[model samples]
Target: MEYRKIFYNVSEKDMSFEDVIDRLKTFITADPRSEYVLSVGTDSHVHAKDTKFITAIHLHRKGKGAWGCLQNTFINRQINSIHEKISIETSLSQEVAYHFTSDYLVELSELLIPFSDEGADLTFEIHLDIGRKGVTKDLIQEMTGRVLAMGVEAKIKPDSYTAFGYANRYTR
Candidate 1:
């Protein structure tokens, strides 16, 4: 439950789910006019006997910059298959996105109503680490489809900064 602020300045420390949700709410409530794009992504690093998974949530405020937080977990198992690794990463990201959608997003939506007429559209994106240029290329479709089935948009590879940038940075 560690919190790593990637785009904005904030003290990094372990945070509870409630703390994370409150931080996210603060970002939205502070700027009602800004359109928000929320995204989740995960990256993993496998060691000798364990795998470290880092997941991130990016709250992008349209043209204005964005702020994000990350959490990591360590699994005491060797992940040797690329497909399994990518699937796990996508799963982790999806789970976090689901939490935001099911819980925090509802609260944010109420705040967004007054701004609806002003053209504020919320976009929740699931960023995947797979792309068409690497070995993960073969997995792009399946992973993207999984996200789509969840009724959310998906971004892969070159477009998935949350996974490759923030999450990857802390996956040690």
Candidate 2:
């Protein structure tokens, strides 16, 4: 098993979550490996409106013992959040929770990368907070374009029920 982390110091004033997603897609596609797991991190600032910057980490594993590797990778990148908790929910419904110091967020974000030798199937989950409605719309548009270009099937969720119904699931 292998783990990789990547960090981006996003200029909150200029870049939105959509821009980060586009760059992430490019980074992933540029690699030759077919399987990976990605986790993205964004800080929730107390004083300012959520900036939505992210750190993405990928875990690669092969064959029968892959789950253990994935779990370890997740543990290594865990961060302690005042408002949120990082927990591992296993297939059997067992959950393990831990608290981490604030500095680990950057460390975890810097770990996102291709674990080319692990030989397992690839999966990804991105965690981000979109602060405004207009920016969210733009971000969704950009995300749609990148996902389509990659030829990967995805499911997109919006804040409300009636706004957009799973745009990634059905192509227009």
Candidate 3:
């Protein structure tokens, strides 16, 4: 199946990884003086006998406008536990962040350093859907630790819009 990656105003459906890198470069340069924060997150919903998962990559231009891409998949397994569901969601987001750093870091760093040198901090983040006020509270430490171990920062509920906001939209 084709990877249906959607941006805020466009769809990057079927685009290659290299193409995504290029488009991201264009997005960053579009706001020359804006600080940037790149994030990866995933949200899942169990429907019928399957689970729908949506993973998103976002580029936030601080106080300016932002855009990102998303990829979704459907799993046939019937996951009954909340722990399993949230753990899988965190893993998906971490996978994307891992790829962003390992597969495209050289290219992304080249594109982002100029802005960083100009006083714009170009940081990367992994968004977890767990929050302190819910059943997911217990998993925060483990999930955040996994993300931090991968060398990227992690944000949880209330602060992780990429997971609950953007990725959630397509989980249905």
lDDT of each: 0.80, 0.29, 0.79
lDDT, candidate 1, equals: 0.80
Model 2, 158: alpha-carbon shift in Å? 31
* 1-172: candidate 2 lDDT, tens digit per residue: 1112222232223333334345445544454344544332222222232222122222323232111101111223333442232111111011110111122223334434545555424543332232235444345444434333433322234321111211111111
Which parts of model 1 have CA positions greater than 4 angstroms off? 1-10, 113-119
Alpha-carbon deviation at 29 in model 1, angstroms: 1.7
| Cα shift from native, residue 94, model 1 (Å) | 1.5
In candidate 3, which residue pairs clash?
none
Candidate 1 lDDT over 1-172, as tens digits, reads 3323322224656666677777777877777678888889999999999999888888888888887888777789989899999999999888887777676666766666354575465678999988889799999889999999988899987999889987888887
Q: Candidate 1, clashing residue pairs?
A: none
RMSD of each: 3.8, 17.0, 3.3
lDDT of 2 at 67: 16
Query: 121 in model 2: Cα distance from truth in Å?
Result: 3.4
Which 10-residue window of candidate 2 scores lowest in summed lDDT?
Answer: 90-99
Task: Report the candidate with higher TM-score, 2 versus 3.
Answer: 3
Cα deviation in Å at residue 30, candidate 2? 1.0
